[model samples]
Target: MRTLAAFFLCVCALPLWAQEDAGALAREAGAQLEAASVRLAEAESARNRVRALTDTVHAYEAGLSAMRAGLRRAAIREAQLRAQLQARDAEIAQLVAVLQTLTPDEAPTAFLHPDGPNGTARAGMLLAELTPALNQRAAQLRKDLSDVESLRLLQEQAAAQLQTGLTEVQTARSALNQAMAERTDLPQRFSEDPVRTAILIASAETLDAFSSGLASIVEGDVGWTPPEVDDLIGEFPMPARGVILRRAGEPDAAGIARPGILLATRPGTLVSAPTAATLRYVGPLLDFGTVTILEPRPGTLIVLAGMAVSYGKTGQIIAASTPLGLMGGLPASNGPSTGGEGGGAERSETLYIEVRENNVPMDPLEWFSTEQDG
Candidate 1:
């Protein structure tokens, strides 16, 4: 009987020991899975960072190229103006010499003698003939002087532009270097699906279509949660600081109804992201100078147009208030002009800001600060 009881106890204990072993194995597997998930997230973050840096480097390069081109053009214009000015100066000198020769001397001469009436009459006729010629030369000198002044003004403007371009180029180069240094070794997000990308690129008819296709692909992930616009309302800042020249629904200079607000800013004004966003596109579009489109959240897009230079690349994530690029040349003078801060020289440029929801245009004024509405 004692032997039988001992056997029964050992058998019952075997099942409990087996259950404990199974539980321990399950816990170990769960811990390993959790660690893998963490590592994958870390890898994705690093990849995004490398991609952003690469895009920034590319943007700086593009900006530098544009600035170099502008500098070359300005140099050419300056040379032409200098040549014209030299020619005008030569013509003026010749006119002065002719005038000096035509003028009568202060001392008495044979023609000035009144002893013979023929001599005096001849002198009077000579004087009359010379009067018209003197007047003509005077008028020509005045016109030439005006042309010189105009040319001088142009040269001054060109010089200023050249200097600005040089400074910008240097700044962009530094930024490029920094970005390159910060870049990490990680695969780019876009390269993950080359086959689909190649197909889209081949099929897209226009840049707009291409951008739309890319946006769709980017937003296709089922886990993404778009931020509510209401939550961001009044919380975001303007991409650039300037006076509002035209509000949405108002007629623009071309007499077309504008879907965005046009802000009059100074040239080379730094443009930044109004909110945390992912860049969708950055390049020239038809009629709209260099443009940059950003998506702050899924289904919402913000468009910044009329920039002279654009920085940052497509698909790069940008934090709020991060520098995008500088505003390009001044816009057409048809837009309203407002004084800037500190009584500085008034320089005006038009920046078009548009916000779209699900690709439908919406008034950006509703989203911007009320204090900036003026």
Candidate 2:
């Protein structure tokens, strides 16, 4: 009986372990949203409004992400519990019937074996032990049912949270847009020469050729002292929150390999500069929809491409975590993107990051921090 009880406990534990404390997670989501709101308010009075708003926008994004995750888990857990209960309906009914027949006064006699006195003694002992185990199972059934109802309720209430989070994040992004536009603090490097750029674009045959000849298209000299990143060698900020689709030199489904890494992100996801850098080039290049090349130092360049809407123009000096652009797709203000980045068209928009040192391609993974701060 002890062994069987332990076995039942182990089996029950599987489903219990799969179930997260959704109420706690939902509360956490609310806390995240509240923090984001507070951050949004703080951004208004901060000396560096751009950076503050940027942080605020990211906070909202994180909140929305948490809300979505909580809701998704609740939905799955609720369904799992429901299915388990439903599949065990017949067994539950049989268990109830057996318990009903085992009245307190008559249960011992009903469970007693017909063999003899020795059999009767063993049967009585079995009845004594079985009663508690049956009671335990019945109690567990009630709890599982209660959990299912609670998860269902949590999911139903999540729509309001999602809507509020969506609206606030949109407001934050708009404020950030306005802030970035009005900013006059960042140092100016040099404006790009459109005539020379157009000529170079027309004549260049590849991204490498365009990047190699970019120095000639600059209309003026850059005098701003660029920020050094020696200490950030292995801890550079991630450009955006995403799932890595391919690492440097990894082949895609088409078997085409590139030196850069690719990230799968939700549409309209914010893409920020990994570090302080000057915008060397910001325009369309061959095959790549839109590209922004940043020169963080003398010999290094950070190339980010495939943004749906980019912010800064060529030659603008931007700081670390500054909003550079948005990934292709709808903004996070609309509806949150689901998991399974490997599927979904909206989640399919990718950001390509290439790091170069002295005009030579380097492993992008080495330069980017693995943490998802963006």
Candidate 3:
């Protein structure tokens, strides 16, 4: 009877042991799942950070390129001014020689000369003949002097601009180095369909066509979803701080109605995102220079063109206030009204901002902060 009781006790203990083992296994699985989730979150954060840094580096590079171009232009202008000054000097010297030769060395007196009337009459005739020439030469000299002064002023300005550009390039390079140092290893969220992307890039002739192709790909992808950006409109800041040089609907130099607002910004000025957005395209687009296109929401796109350099790859999501790129150069207030001469130190940069809804252009003023409206 005791042996039978022992067997029954062992049988009951077996089930209890199995149950404890199962619970332990379940706990282990739960712990692993939690750990994986944490790792994923960390990876996502790292990726975003790297993306932001990449964009900043691109912008700085663009700014540096612009500065260098400006420097080259300033140097050219300086050479031209020097040549003009040399020519003006020669002309002035010739005019002075003629004036000196025409003028009398001493005053004539009737008491000191026997042929006084004849001499006086000849003197008067000579003076009359030279009067018009003297006046013309004097006027020409005055105009030349003014021009020389203007040229001198322009040279000083150009020198200052060149120095500023050098400084900006140094600062941008340092910042770029720092950004690179902060980079972390992170897995990409989506695998790039190289074949499809290459085909699209090759076939698309215009920016609009390229944009359409990208939109189709984004929509077809099941893993990606457009972020809700409408709620953040007007709550964000402008990409860069600068004066509005031109507004939407204004006629540009090409006589085409501008679909965007152009901001005259300082050279190497920092540019950031106004709101959370997904980068769609970043590259050169015809006469627009280096362009960056972002999708803040589905069916809505924001275009930033006229950059010297661009950052970030396609499909990367960026947070608000993230650095995108820097402005290329300063705008020339004294230059022609048309977008200032390109690649010159005297010329300033214009950041073109355009907002599109369903591929149709819209005024960007309504979306920017009140501070930017002016």
Instruction: Give TM per candidate.
Output: 0.43, 0.84, 0.48
Candidate 3, clashing residue pairs? 62-309, 330-348, 331-348
Better of 2 and 3 by TM-score: 2
* lDDT of each residue in 1-374, candidate 1, tens digit only: 23323433443342211111212222333333334334333433454543443333333323323333343444454455456557557544644665565556776673454557776786567656555755654664465445446545544544444343334333433343344355443222231244655676678765456557764444333232334557777666777656788889999678987688898875546577877777766666656778798877877888899876677765566667666776655333313222121124334677889888787788888787746421
Model 2: weakest 10-residue lDDT segment is 334-343
As a whole number from 0 to 100, the lDDT of residue 247 in candidate 2 is: 92
lDDT of 1: 0.55
Tell me the number of clashing residue pairs for each predicted model.
Answer: 1, 0, 3
Best TM-score goes to which candidate? 2
Per-residue error for 124 in candidate 2, Å, reads: 4.4
Mark the regions of model 1 whose C-alpha exceeds 4 Å error after superposition. 1-229, 330-345, 370-374
TM-score, candidate 3, is 0.48
lDDT of 3: 0.57
lDDT string for model 3 (1-374, tens) is 23323433443342211111112222333333334334333433464544544343334334434434443444454455456557557545655665664555676542232556776576566557555755564565575455446545544654454344344333333444355355444222343466666777778786667767775444334344656767667655777766688899999888877788998765555567787777777666666887888777778889998776465666667677666665665333322221222234332667899988888888888788647421
lDDT of 2 by residue, 186-212 (tens): 777888889999999899987778878
What is the Å distance of residue 334 in model 1 from its true position?
29
Worst 10 residues of 3 by lDDT: 14-23
TM-score of 2: 0.84
